[model samples]
Target chain A: MSRLLESFRIALRGLVANKVRAALTMLGIIIGVAAVIALVSIGEGFSAYVSGELEGLGTRTLFVWTNRDAANPQQLTTADAEALADPLACPGIEAVAPAYQQGATATYAGIETSPNVSGVTPEYLTVQSYDMKVGRFIEQDDVDHRGRVAVLGSTPASDLFPGSAYPIGETIRLNDVPFEVIGVMAEKGSTGPMDNDDVVLIPLTTAQTRLFTVDTVRGDYVVSSINVLVQSEDMLDSTIEDVSAVLRERHRIQPGDTDDFQVRNPSDMVETVTGITTTLTIFLGAIAAISLLVGGIGIMNIMLVSVTERTREIGLRKAVGAGKSDILWQFLIEAVVMSLIGGLLGIGLGTAISQIAGSALDMQTVVSVNSVGLAFGFSAAVGVFFGIYPAMRAANLHPIDALRYE
Target chain B: MIEPVIDVRDLTKVYQMGEVEVHALRGVSMQVMPGEMVAIMGPSGSGKSTLMNMLGCLDTPTSGEYYLEGAAVSDLNDQGLTSIRRHKVGFVFQTYNLLSRTSALANVEIPLIYGGVPRRQRRQRAIEALEMVGLGDRLHHQPNELSGGEQQRVAVARSLASEPAIILADEPTGNLDTRSGKEVMAVFQQLNRERGITVILVTHDPDIARHAQRIIWVRDGLVERAEQVGDRILADDSQGSEEDKGQAVAVAALDASGTFEEVAS
Candidate 1:
């Protein structure tokens, strides 16, 4: 222990003797560690942003959209929407809503706006992941009675009624027909390329009959397409497959005939997002790891110079009875100390940069404690790995030659 | 009457630089008794430094036997040689090779540290060593802050800290001013006389060699002459008396500078 302490003192003295050189050497490691932390944090933030986008799409919602059959333009119907609600055939199916969308001009007072009008039942609130901010959404009674009541999404309501004192319970004319606004949806941001909070909703029957005015309704009346809400994420895939098979049978489509409907499971969205985030993390970690490599190389280069500069000292210590292991350990300790300091500095810089980026870019910057651990561990490992050659060179030096060195 | 502390028989050291084999020591034999102060003197390239290195166990002889206090040193491996150096021999360099950034106390304590001494004990011993060399107050002073004489004194103190049987100094006063050189030589004399530590100094200066009771002159890698001085500059009667009584004739002849001619005859 005394010998080790003496060695440490000697190593510190050697480093202190060349102040500018030592600081410059440490600079390489510092930059390397800082780069690792900053790059990895940025990558982490990007991944979180993507994952948050996927989460906004809803957890247990399954989307069924119309796949136009070129051969038969009139394909999906109300019967297909009703089949999804059957408890036996499609187990764990929570609720189903038939949706029909049409672009139309909405007018209130002097304002005129073209909004995408969606026709849906009360269950459409659950399937589309809409939450009411004021008033109520379409109820079962409204759907049964084919009421001409409407729900305004935050964007359309704000646009048409721009600071109006009354929005909910106020009547808005859709294509010259008056419909009472029953509810206004809360802000839902946006989902990738689509804005969910921009549309207006009314009962499916009212939208199909009053808005579009196609009596036979063709394939578009299957309420544009059925929205199947599953009870949980675990039942999603099977429910989607069951619904697809039933729809195929109902529409009498042959195998591989390009069905007149499309089945979309929400879990696929989650899985796709998870895969992307994992890849992003790995990619970011790899780029960050390059800094560690550069830092290790810096350590090696500095240690080599240290060994050369301390040749006479090594000789003197050996002449005074220090063994080869002693010389090796002294140089090794210097390298380790340099790297450890760099690692700590890197952690601090990385965390600060991540916080700044998180707020400035409006991204989720999650700095993992494990990443700190990994960074420190990597720094120490780099110290050891880079320290070896210099330590060996010091140890291998002959006391005679070392003593003779000027 | 006492067995020699160091025994060398037919020792030779050859240095090969590229193709030339320079014979530094060629079939030289000598003995140094315990507590004896000896000086080896020769001109440049006369192989005095080579002999000193071999005696200090810092280098191995190309051929011959060397025994330190009865243990054979010539056959010992590098680790064994280090142990011999740590426990049985200490060295002072001409340049006073104290670690540049270290304090005098730390420099002196290093040998003891390698000997596995505990920190407290090493500290105490280092202080005592420095005190003995008259530099106890300068313990915290680094080599750069110290005078050439003080630096050499610190090196001498380091040599004494390990309590080795012999201190091999290669031109201990070479880099110092005359006054400081004399001061350093005085410390070496004191260590030899009072502590009964053997001192073997290499020098070409007759004035520096005058401090030792016995002087060995080397030329062309061989011992040209060996002589004893009758009156050693020490208050310790034991070392002076023992050296005087045993080789009185040799000492008398060397005191007159006639011993070299007699040995050549």
Candidate 2:
């Protein structure tokens, strides 16, 4: 124990004698550890943000879209959507909303902006978990009567009316077709690649007959997609199966053939995106780990140089009765001390950098305890791994040859 | 009869220099009784340094039986040789070999540290060793802060701290001037006479060789002759007697002139 303490003192003195070289060697480890922490924190924050966005829509919600890649492409209709709402047909399903959408420029007071013009029923708000900001959403009476009424999402409302004037009771033009704006929706924000707030909602009947007229193949209006809200989170999988069965029967898909439509669970998408993001995080960490590998090499390089420089010292110590293990431990401890100190400083610097970046980018950054432990442990391992060769080189030197080293 | 401090019989050392074998020592035999100060003198390549290394336990002889303080050393393993060196042998080098940035006291404590001496006892012994070499006041000074002779004295103190049975000095004052060399020799002689410690000096200088009670001459890897000096030169006028106060004053005077004469001469 006393000999070990003495070796520590000797190692410390050796490092202190060459301050610049020692500090430079430690810089490699510092940068490597810092990069690992900062990049990982940012990556973790991104995945968390995406998961939160997906959770906002509710886990029980599922989206069904027409699959254009099917051998016989099928179009989803309002009739098929209505059929899914039958309680006996889909007991797990609570509500369903059918929607058709087209991108067009919206104009009010000569200000023009692009927004998705969507035709949806009143149940769209319930199924999508959206609340009204001021006035009521589209009702069944408006669809039956084919009333030229519209509801503005928060983004289109702001775009059409830059001033704080009430958007209700105002007339807006969509693709040169005028419609009365009856209500302004609350903010739903954006998720993935689609912006929920950049939309203008109208009655299904009015949009099909007046603005976007299509040839009636089966005397039914077609919708782009259908959103189904399940009764509970636990019933979501059964509800998706129920909806898939309904759509498959409606599209006349054969038992041996693939379905012409796809039912998507929002939670599944969250899992997949989270998986991708986690992979991205690990890839970033591995890239940072390459720098750590280089840092280990740097330590090895410096230790080798130190061994060569202190050959005479090694000889002198051996002459004074220091054993091989003593010399080996001395050099090994010096290397570990350098890397461990660098790891600590890197953690502090990395945490600070991540916090600053998080606030600047307006995103959450998490510096988990696991990442800190991993980085610290890895740096120590690197010290031991790299320190071995040089320490052995020093220990194995014949005392006479070492003393004679010029 | 007192057992000899060192006993060697037909010791030989052969070095493999790539494709050639160089016989450095060939069947050398010698012994030194306890408390005797002896010098091994030879020109370069005469195996004097190799013999010193063998005696110091830094290297094992290729062939023969050797014993240090009555224990057989020729067949010991590396660990045993290190243990023998730690407990029974202390080495002083031509270059002083003190750690450059370390204090004189710390340098002196190194051998004791390797010997696993307790910290307090190590410090006490180191201080005593420094005072033994007349450098009690220079303990905290680094090798760079002290003169060449002072550094050599620190090295001597380092060797003495372990309380080894024998001190092997290889050209101990080679780097110092005549004054520092005489001071170092005086320290060795005083340690031999007062503490009854056995000391061996390896040098080619006749002036340095004459300070020892006996001289062993080596030529071409073999001992040429062994002789006793009729009139040996005392390194200092106050060396033969126990005069601590007078020796301190003389050391103080030498300390003042220690660095000056080396630069001038």
Candidate 3:
């Protein structure tokens, strides 16, 4: 141990003697490690943020959207949503909310704007997790009575009402159909490409009768799609299977017939986004890895030069009782120290740079302990691996030939 | 039946240069008793350097038995040879071979460090060695900072610091002036006399060769003759050592200074 330590000190002295060369040698490793950290951190941050946002839509929620067959064009109805809520019929389903949507202008005291108006049942609040900012959402009674009451999304409420107008109890006109605003939705921000904040929600009966002029006696309550919430994430596939069976049965579709509805899960969305982020990280990481490879080669190059330059010294040491292994270790330790220091500096620099870039670009950046350790350990391994060739060359030199070197 | 400090019998060294074979040494047999002061004299390409390397354990003989202090060194492997070099022998080179940018004290400490001496003791012993060579004041000075003679003295101190049984000097004074050469010779004589160190010098100068008790003349891969010096340099007789001989001899092979004639008349 003492002998190794002595060699380490000697190696440090050798490096210290050539300051510029040592620093220049370390530069490659520094840049390589820094690039890896920055790219990896950004990628991880983006994936995490995206996954979090996707999870906010609820992992167990199955989206049954309209994949309308061009031949039939069979639209969904309130019966499909009601059929999915039966515990014995749909084993993995917890709740179902079918919605019919249309574009309509909401006007309240001269403040007017065209926003998406969604007609939904009371289960929409529990299934979609929409928090009430003020007043209450539409109840079962409102849907049954075909009451002319509406719920405003944050953006629509703000736009359709004057400053501090208290949207609750205020009467709003949707396509010239007057309705009292019973509640306003809490701000939920943007969901991917959709602006959920700029929407209006009302009873399905009201939308079917008062807005779309559909007859309840005919019972053809056309809905764009239904939101089916699964009981648990583990049973999401079975829930979709059960819902598909029920919907097919309810729509009176025969065997081998193509259904007009699609059952999708948020996990698929999460996978798509996470897949893109991972590919981007790996692509950038590969480029950074190439730089690391270049840095390793640089270390090898410098170590070779150092061995050649110190040939006589090597010979002298051998003559004075140092062994070949001793000489090999000396050079190896020098290379490792150079690369290790570079790795540490790169970690610091990369973290700082990524944080700065994250704030500047208004993107999330995460620096984990695992990433730092991985970079540091990899750089050291690079040092050892690259240092081996030059160290072997030094160790292979004969004492006599080396000593006699001019 | 005491064993010789250095023993070699029928020693031969052959170098293979592509398809050609160069014989550096041929059946060279010699022995030096313990505590003997000897010089091996030869011109360039005469196998003296090769023999010096063989004695120093830096190279293995092609064929022959070389026993040092009763151990068969010719049979030893590279690791064994390194052990021999580390503990049994010390070397002084013509160029000093000190690591540039390193302090003289640090340079001297290298041998002891390799020998596994503790750090504090290594420093103390290196200082003692430097002081012995009259360069105690220049311990921290780098090689480039020191004069040629001072640098040579530092090399000698390094060789002495190991406390080896035999000191092998290959042209120790070849790069110095006459005064520095004599000064180095004086230090060698002092160590040989007081500390009872066995010293072997490889030299081209006849005057420097006379400083040893005996000299071997080598020519064309063979020892031509062994000569005992009629007048040797006493350790305390630096002033009386410059006596001029009134004759001429074949000493033209070495550097000629218009001073004392120490060659055979």
lDDT of 1 at B104: 97
Best prediction by DockQ:
3
How much lDDT does candidate 2 score?
0.86
lDDT of 3 by residue, A222-289 (tens): 77779988878899988888988988887778888787688899899899999999999989888997
Of all true interface contacts, what fraction is found in model 1?
0.67
Whole-model alpha-carbon lDDT for candidate 1: 0.82
The chain B TM-scores of all candidates, as shown, are 0.89, 0.86, 0.86
Q: Per-residue lDDT tens digits of candidate 2, residues B1-265?
A: 4666788877899999999999999877777777878899988999989999999999999998888878899999989988887888889999889898789999999888899999899899999999999999998999999999999999999999999878999999789899999999999989988887888999978999888877787877877666655222322222323434321211111122111010101
For candidate 2, the per-residue lDDT at A128 reads 81
The interface root-mean-square deviation of each model, in the order shown, is 1.4, 0.9, 0.8
Model 2, A90-121: lDDT tens per residue? Answer: 99988999988888888888999999988888
Whole-model lDDT per candidate = 0.82, 0.86, 0.85
**Superposed Cα deviation of residue A299, candidate 3 (Å):** 0.4
Q: When only chain A is evaluated, what TM-score does every model earn? A: 0.87, 0.90, 0.91
Q: Where does candidate 2 stray beyond 4 Å?
A: A87-91, A103-115, A133-186, A210-215, A232-241, A254-258, B117-123, B144-147, B223-225, B228-265
lDDT of 3 by residue, B137-220 (tens): 999999999988889999999999989878999999999999999999999988887887889999999999988877887777
Arranged by lDDT, best first:
2, 3, 1
- For B1-265, candidate 1 gives per-residue lDDT tens digits of 4677888888888999899999988777887778889899988898989889889878889999998998888999888988977888899999888988789999999889889898899999999999999998998999999999999999999988999989999999899899999999999888887888889999878999989988888888888777776344332335445543564534322322112321211
List the candidates' TM-scores in order: 0.86, 0.86, 0.90
